[model samples]
Target: MLGTIIVGVILVIIVALIVRSMVHDKKNGKSFTCGGDCGKCKGHCH
Candidate 1:
């Protein structure tokens, strides 16, 4: 119905925004795998 369509559209928009934010962070050199605990990292975060 109309409600279902609206919800789907909203879900898509939210997902797109999340993806955009992740891309922006990546462009700024943000690391998603580094938990800021370099002591336990596998030395690949850099």
Candidate 2:
């Protein structure tokens, strides 16, 4: 039914976002946390 299709599409989108975020975090050497404070960590990171 239409409802089932909608649910399936949403699930696919969520999975894609998770995969994208993981790759982005790995490339930036950052964990899943985005506290954004950066604080002292910024100096060594940049």
Candidate 3:
């Protein structure tokens, strides 16, 4: 039971960190996609 609680807490922390980072990126006008300047891509996975 203690182990399960610890795992859940860790998972929550990880998710929180990811959410925070995404919010930060959005505020900075950043994209979490390919992270490149290929130009032709234009935000598409193609």
Which model scores highest in TM-score? 3
**Where is model 2 poorest over a 10-residue stretch in terms of lDDT?**
31-40
Which pairs clash in model 2?
Answer: none
- For residues 1-46, what per-residue lDDT tens digits would candidate 1 score against the true structure? 9999999999999999988987887787766666434456767767
TM-score leaderboard ranking: 3, 1, 2
TM-score of 1: 0.71
Superposed by TM-score, candidate 2 places the C-alpha of residue 6 at a distance from the truth, in angstroms, of: 0.2
Those runs of model 2 whose alpha carbons end farther than 4 Å from true positions after fitting are: 31-46
Cα lDDT tens digits for candidate 3, 1-46: 9999999999999999999998887677666674434364675733
Q: Which prediction has the highest lDDT against the true structure? A: 1
What is the number of backbone collisions in each predicted candidate, taken in the order shown?
0, 0, 0
Better of 1 and 3 by TM-score: 3
lDDT of the candidates, in the order given = 0.78, 0.73, 0.76
